[model samples]
Target: MRDVAGSWKDLTDDANFMAGTLTGQVRDIAFVTTAVATGDLSKKVMMDMCGELLKLKDSISFARSDRERPLDVEPVGGGGTDAV
Candidate 1:
């Protein structure tokens, strides 16, 4: 059971790492788009960066929703507790 718990922790860490990396990539693309739009860079480059940024944003939203899902729990025993 200890080993299983350790493995689960490792997996959670990896998922967090991947989410962070996705967010970082989105930020980098936004930066590049701003730099390009300032007339110091190319329009084509800005467009490409914007496209990648949008994709990353969608992915991040999905990941966040998945992470926030409510856990399933059951009530133990009957009648003694007050019902809300």
Candidate 2:
């Protein structure tokens, strides 16, 4: 039962991470396209986009690592008592 719960938590986390990553990428692309349309495509803008892309890649890597490892859960105390 605990194992199943852990798996569900991991799946939820992964889904959240992926959704966040995709949203960020979409936003970045929109920003870049807007800049280009406005004829403001400077070296700095390109560099900024590259940096954001790298960050997205790092996030994906971190998510993959989390999926590969065992899910970590903390114990909670019972009701109003401090003891578990």
Find the candidate with the highest lDDT and give its number: 2
The worst-scoring run of ten residues by lDDT in candidate 2 lies at: 41-50
lDDT of 2: 0.57
Every model: Cα RMSD to truth: 22.5, 24.7
Q: What local lDDT does model 1 show for residue 31?
A: 64
In order of appearance, the predictions have TM-scores of 0.42, 0.46
lDDT of 1 at 7: 73
lDDT by residue for model 2 (1-84), tens: 144557798888788887787677667656655654565544122223347676754554454455457867666675456983
lDDT of 1 by residue, 1-84 (tens): 144567798988888887787666656656645654464343222222246566764554454455457877677555468665
* Candidate 1: residue 44 lDDT (0-100): 23
lDDT of each: 0.56, 0.57
Candidate 2 TM-score over all chains jointly? 0.46
Clashes of each: 0, 0
Looking at model 2, residue 56 earns an lDDT score of 57
Please list the residue runs of candidate 1 whose C-alpha ends up more than 4 Å from where it truly belongs after superposition. Answer: 1-4, 42-84
